[model samples]
Target chain A: MIDIKNKIKEYLTKKDTKFNSIFEINKMSGGSSNEIWIIKYLDNNTENKIVFRRHYSRISEKENLYPPLSLSIESEVMAVAYKQKIPVPKIIYNVDKDHELGESFFMEFIDGITLGNKIVENRSVKLLKPNLASQCGEILGKIHSIPYQNIKDLNTSTGIDEMRKYKNIYQDYSLNIPVFNLSFKWLEKNIPPVTNKCLVHGDYRNGNIVVSSSIGIKSILDWELLHLGDRHEDLAWICVNSWRFGKIKLPVGGFGLRNDFYNAYEQSSKKKLNKESLKFWEILGTLKWGIMCLKMYDAYKSGYDRSVDRAAIGRRSSETEIDLLRLIDNEDRYE
Target chain B: MNNPPSKEELITSVIEFIENDIIDELVGQKRFHAHVAKNSLQIILRQLKLEEKNNRFEKNRLKEILKMDKDLNELNKILCQKIDYEEIDINNNDLIDHLFKTTMEKLSIDQPNYSAYLDEKTN
Candidate 1:
């Protein structure tokens, strides 16, 4: 096993001129397949912290429902977003050529609450909750408005293409989920026409953001899902019931109403929000989450990640099933 | 025959042990994982208590909607294929009602406290 701690220390010393030595290296819980470490180092006799996120090969690509964007793509998107004055972490280092460290990047860690339950519960930042919807809208507006030529490397996948991708992954599991079949059938029949594709922050929910009481969203983390897609994909994903964290009444990431979010997004992006597209993407997003849960279960079943957490997450597909039924139900249960 | 402590009782004992004894003793990641373990066991207990009744209702619903008889797994698999092939209309009232009720029963076992499930239950 490579001594990752020593490699990180050596890399920091080589990259940062003022770097002295490491103080502490703690691992933070990251995505299911990624490893994130908090590196506290002594730079010019000052203690500083940075996050080192590395995508590990613990789970292979075949196990995942959606393959994550490459770490280089993630770093590039973060750099571009930062340049555009979007609320995102600053990329300190992009390690592409390094063969040993593998696919990873070092970023300046922004401190705030990134927990979905805490954000939705409105415990610490009661004032920040109401304004979060608009802040997200504004951020997403800026993200979607990013010029196509700037992020030319991002492969654009349309809504139908995305639906087909998830459906293919679902079939790969070969598990018969009636609700999932209904959702796929409904999405196939009601798939929205391909709109103008832009930089879509594929996962832009409350959990992926760092929020403070003072500054609403300090930085947007987790750009692994970044892709070129319809702007409504970003907008509707936040409204998915799974991200609401039990605060389903408040649809916009369980923070504020959709009207505020749409108005703010409209003001920022100068694009009218389409209700039909948003609704379609919302259902699609829910089904995607459900399939993702099944993927987690597959990981456990396949013995790639045999943790209790993953096993329990398999049961969570039912949550998305109820949410999907609610969304597709013509009685307007989504209201 | 198995003795005084039934399967549900055994699970309840473990959950109480975790809640009252083990969880507080541990900190940080260990405690968090202990909670997850307890929750997983609770889910199993809920499934044990509810699966038979839920399956019976689900099978009855499937029989009514599909107008045919089969075992639960076979019927569910058939329902999925029928939905896939567009044999049953997505907007059919009986189908929708069946899906809704089945999902609710599932949530009762999987996550009883889920917000949408609770909302639907109260409604």
Candidate 2:
């Protein structure tokens, strides 16, 4: 047996924690980019269990494909979000040193189900439909309400220029996925004139959210792609059809109508929901997600962490492309 | 002559053996190795089913789009080369929809209910 127990114990001791024994250490499921472990410790009649996230080289030889800034960037965003009073797990410890558990961090293991495919099957949460969009809007409003000046560490500063930043990021990343080339060209030709900027949760959709049976949205997870950008980017992301489960009618995370979500946001944030701007953002969101899937697919093909989840994600590009087409078609009809 | 085990059967058998026999008996690196092996097997199985079809359909759709927009070879090449996040013409929604429909038709995939999506947007 490989003694990860000694390694974990040593690390805990160094962190100035008095622990007599390490009872159970098992890997947790879900996460394509990082390894997660649930570790339980016994210290003087007290038992404590905490989760650890460790970044590993997905591609054995091509260890540098995943940019160095990826993990630290995510950690920085999480810290900033935590400071802004965002509902997220309290980060207990962060270690960038490869020697200590190999690119890792320790955080309070949140006890809630990630809202993924299983969300549709879970009936208890299903009953909260009408309130779901409103709740989402309120949560998003709170996130967007964070003062831009306060979040100094967020690499990208908040401004109207964020649209240009998104365009650049998308252009660079989309080069790897051949299918999105046309979409990129189209986006270039139809770059909507930007008016407002806010803290955009780059991937604020169903998969990243956590829901509870007793409580509502426990926390928003996955800050790896967070950026300071247009507020409509987040709204459009939530309204994407791919996230709408099987019910296309219920646009906002497939839980409630779009107007309800918009009304809730307007009431909570006191900001107008610009319909034309939102339509443009929706197209962008679909293209972004679709391109992201293709990128993941390329990674899989290149033997970068051959996970079924990654492969499954790659297939979703088709759905996103479909959404993009529909959004574009709607725009044409109106014109 | 006996035929070689299909990719699906091979993956299924390996997963079953690991879950039933090796996983319970193993610990630490051995268990981790087994788990990784099982996951890799599943990934391979999915790829075997999906990759060929995905590529074939994408190529066919790209060709069709090129045919439709004759004299736009440069644009077609760019479009066929990659999928971009912010790379869509929101103003020319009809053209975008046509490309999407053509792609779907080529792939033999069912088109999403655009009207339903539109209704959601309008409401």
Candidate 3:
């Protein structure tokens, strides 16, 4: 790779003169929007483990055009959410422009499985399945309860804005996805009323968090799309078909019942949830994720990144399309 | 174009080789990469075996529903444009049926193991 260890060591030495050596730096796989390296360094005969997250510069122009937020913004959001009793990685250090590794930050590495399939797979993390769904709802409640006024200036998005944005992304790919159009039409005709505004974790799915088989959700990761929007969006997103990891019958993250999830949210936030709005955002989240798959395809087709992961993800758009058909035909709601 | 080893046979052989040879020796990241390679080969096989039949089925359905003959891509583009302009008869059974069947057909190759695909197939 780029020998990032030397740069990290140099930067650490400046922050503290004792950090004179790097013990080991392992590049964690499954990197997408950012380059994540789990690093071990020695400072004053003491060893420390930290996750080094830095922006990947070689992303295609289309993917970069959206989401103008910086890593510092993510750090700030994490800090805010942590204060509100949300389980999140501790912000070790927020990198400034003076550091040579470009825009990056450090967080205390939390140990847990993050793979969606393993999170609820029978042979894997099946122990976590019993309590994860309700625990997920409670976590989202804590996040959504964070006051809108506190984080509104963070360049976030609202429901209508997100709808328009999803449309741009869908059309931007230049692929003929008729199912997307059908969903878009339905969303256009059925825009739910903006009852209130709150902090919405734009990507609150199974793979986006760290979960232990015993403790449930340890850290809610991936706040790159953290925004001020419908609180229901966060609740609905975890229920998307792909997020369920094949336990399609269980609507809430493929483990627990939806009724239990709703009860947990109502208990934690102490607020009555608007079910209709939740359904609206659920549809929106499905459409957005579907478009995200196509975005990966576009990235690969245009000679940006040629990872097999991207190519495989490109084929998953049909999964979203099938999910959309299920949703639009009203079978999803009954299930 | 039919050679000694047919396209399907070659694809299957390559996939089996990757699964038995390279994948077993790999660990961690290399193992994951090998898994991806295996899936990719399987996807290619699926596309080769099913794409023609799927395309013909879709084209026939589109022709019957829209009452016109056009290239497959062109027909799909037309359907999307019609939806964009709100000209689609959303409640029509024929249109929804076409969408459902086409999606399931694609998933039969794309992700036959996907839960929804199995659920639909069961029904």
lDDT of 2 by residue, A150-239 (tens): 544564433224445444554654344333455545555566656566777767887788888556677887665566767777888887
TM-scores, all candidates, are 0.95, 0.68, 0.92
The residue pairs in collision within model 1 are none
Q: What does candidate 1's lDDT look like per residue over A1-335, in tens digits?
A: 78888888888888866655678888778775578999987767778898998976466777755666678888888888899999888998888655678878999988888898888776556576448888888888999887658555687788998899899889988888899999999998887867877888888887999888776889888888778889999898999989988888889888778888999999999998888898899999999999988888888898987888888899999999988998898543544
Report the TM-score of candidate 2, chain B only. Answer: 0.48
What local distance difference test score does each model get?
0.86, 0.63, 0.80
- The TM-score of predicted model 1 comes to 0.95
Which scores greater on DockQ, model 1 or model 3? 1
DockQ comparisons of all candidates to the true complex:
0.92, 0.21, 0.81
How does candidate 1 score on lDDT? 0.86
Interface RMSD for each predicted structure? 0.6, 7.1, 0.8
RMSD versus native structure for model 2: 7.2
Instruction: Score residue B119 of candidate 1 by CA lDDT.
Output: 88
Off-target runs (Cα >4 Å) in candidate 3 are A1-3, A16-21, A30-32, A42-48, A122-130, A148-152, A331-335
Q: Which structure among the candidates has the greatest lDDT?
A: 1
Model 3: residue B18 alpha-carbon error in angstroms = 1.0
Tell me which of candidates 1 and 3 scores higher on lDDT. 1
Which prediction has the highest DockQ against the true structure? 1
